[model samples]
Target: MPAPDLSVSATSAVRVAATVLWTGPDAPREIDAPIVAAVPDPRGWAAGLDVPARRDLADRVLTQLLAGEPVVVLEERGDWLRVVAPWQPSDLDPRGYPGWVPRAHVAQAAVPARTEAVVTVEAVRLEPDPGSRGDGLPSELTYATILPVLAETGTRVRVALPGGGSGWIDARACVVRPTGDGKHVEAGAVFTEARRFVGLPYLWGGMSAFGLDCSGLVHIAFRALGRIVPRDAHDQAEAAGRVPVGEARPGDLYFFARPEKSIHHVGFAAGPGSDGVLLHAPRTGEQVREEQMNADRRATLVDLAGRLAD
Candidate 1:
């Protein structure tokens, strides 16, 4: 029998391709590809659109893929209805693979409340020793809490260092805004929201909005609206639903390894740049901040996992 093909999609980026990543197999059965064409529909990706638009989308996907992106194919409706996308592509991708081509498969993240909307900063909880820990630091960032706050449209919630353990500004003075428009929050909002829970207390296997672990915080952030995502970090990695991190959006989940095993910890990536600074929940004594996540982290977590999760 022939191997089944995976699906992928083009994120917000303009450049996307549809080159080869690799074949299917366990262990070393991985490959990389670029996006070809992007479509908001879930069924008629690169294929649905006209040649002109498809060509433009294809060129971009090629560049990114050749650049060593983790692209993959999702599904196919006959040969004409093929859906291609990056590995673990952002669930929020304007078009995740193809089913969403017509804007189906609704976004997983929830829309926060409108009343009492506010933008605030909460710290991330980290393990005592960033590198090592006494209780065997979690395999992945488990909890990064999210304050019970909301924002108004055009709300500007600013991000600032907590010099003395105080972080709350008026709606007008904030660095970002919060709303429930079903639209991806603006950059400033994303940044602010991402950084909002830095220096927070970390918990073991936590999943609450008040005191979250890495994956827990991510789950709450989007769940506030209406999106249902994986509960823990490892599964969160799988939540990408088939797209790769290379094609991930700002609000997408970023999973890592614990130098131990499985899908371990996960975080929310901010914008492109592959900075490696993921938003996650730390250990009992850590803070929820965008710390320096270097290549070493990837070497431990992602590289070993093999493929970008779906």
Candidate 2:
């Protein structure tokens, strides 16, 4: 589909009201248009997009947006729309995870009032009303899938869905995340939360519970614990304090990369000592699982480990 000319007037302010995908260039750029849809074009993506050096798995991917996440659209060229990401992608990528995304992946709409909620369960149904029997929404809300809180009932909270419309989700399945102190959260508790999605499929650039890449998994686990960390493995390595692998304990992160130049994959420590198993969301086609960081695996140099808390 062609891009919609939703360019706002100089005096009008704009914000994202839906969960759209960011498929822009690896370099920083921006646009002033909302996405049109969330369709993926595998052939087009591989043939046209400049692959980021840090992405581990080269599977078909799309960067997503939670409802009401703001973006600064900078420019439009052909069918691609350039925009600023709300989070950091990496140190090399400019200040706003700037990139070019297909115009088809977004549609312009009025920004709505919103609050953030994190998915607490593996998956939860989204209904049109505040009960299970209410008209069902099409998709399942997965663990760590952040949505904009709309209305709250005793046990359910209405949230704005990515595809549009409000859906009532069981409040028990999600927690309203508020901005505050996160340093008080313990590493063990964070690892416990990391253990929940033990069998999800790995996705490139995904950051939600529905499917997540290695760094995305790490990012979400910390976010669930209320501490927001960098979005990619390399950046996380720089931001968090590190511990030598031999001295690593539970709740520490095991970082893996080839030639030891940059951090690519990350796994949370789930066991103790040299015999510990690291829980991680591995690459494409692999389900998130625990792997014993024994002799052979560590040959890739699971040499560096990090602690979220210094």
The estimated TM-scores of all candidates read: 0.37, 0.69
Q: What is the lDDT, from 0 to 100, of the residue 135 in candidate 2?
A: 25
Best by TM-score: 2
Residue 161 of candidate 1: its Cα lDDT? Answer: 14
Error of 2 at 241 (Å): 0.2
Score each candidate by Cα lDDT: 0.35, 0.58
C-alpha root-mean-square deviation, candidate 2: 8.7
Worst 10 residues of 2 by lDDT: 1-10
**lDDT (Cα) of model 1:** 0.35
Give one digit per residue, the lDDT tens place, for model 1 in 167-253.
233444322323222333233344455466676555433333234456656644543332334444655565444345565555655
Model 2, range 193-260, lDDT digits (tens) per residue? 87777886666666665567778788777766556667778777777777778777777788887783
Please list the residue runs of candidate 2 whose C-alpha ends up more than 4 Å from where it truly belongs after superposition. 1-62, 102-115, 128-140, 147-150, 160-167, 177-183
Shift in Å, residue 301, candidate 2: 2.5
